[model samples]
Target: MLEIVPIRSDSRARARVKVRPPAFLGEPEPDTSVGQEISKAGVGIILCAGALIGLGGFLFFIGGLLTSGGITGFVKGWLTAFTGI
Candidate 1:
């Protein structure tokens, strides 16, 4: 024969509240290094340069001011021919 131990009802009252330490309490603040900032600026500059080049090309072709070397050039030629200007 096995005897089962009974849990006391007062045991629930003894439960303690646990306080968790802040997650970032001991961590260093995020630092954006000079190299990272320079790289980000370089990317932005490259993108802006590409956009400027594309815009210049579009303006030139749209006004029939210059010719290109690809599909855009062919389309511009066709448009100019059809529009007669």
Candidate 2:
């Protein structure tokens, strides 16, 4: 097995260790565009879900308003409102 190791410049038995930058300062930050695009897509999904929920609630309310319990009276009210009679 070939093991790759950094060659030390100092030949002393106890060589000076090279210090690496901290992890926080490690590699250059990844492309931020990818994250931004994901966030944009997430916002779109959230807005779409909200719109669908609102539409569903509206449909439920309309359905309840049209059920047989008082549908005839409700239609008469609309007819009166539209014809002014």
Model 2 alpha-carbon miss at residue 10, Å: 49
> Largest TM-score belongs to which candidate?
2
Question: For model 2, what is the C-alpha lDDT against the true structure?
Answer: 0.76
Q: What lDDT score goes with residue 45 in model 1?
A: 100
Kindly list the per-residue Cα lDDT of model 1 for residues 1-85, writing each as its tens digit.
9999999877755568987555585343356477876787899999999999999998876665444567678787788989998
Q: How many backbone clashes does candidate 1 have?
A: 0
Listed in order, each prediction's TM-score against the native is 0.41, 0.43
CA RMSD per model (angstroms): 11.9, 11.7
* Candidate 2 lDDT, 1-85, residue by residue in tens: 9999998888668568887654464243444466776787899999999999999999976876677357787677678889998
Off by over 4 Å in 1: 1-29, 65-85
Q: Where does candidate 2 stray beyond 4 Å?
A: 1-32, 68-85
Worst 10 residues of 1 by lDDT: 20-29
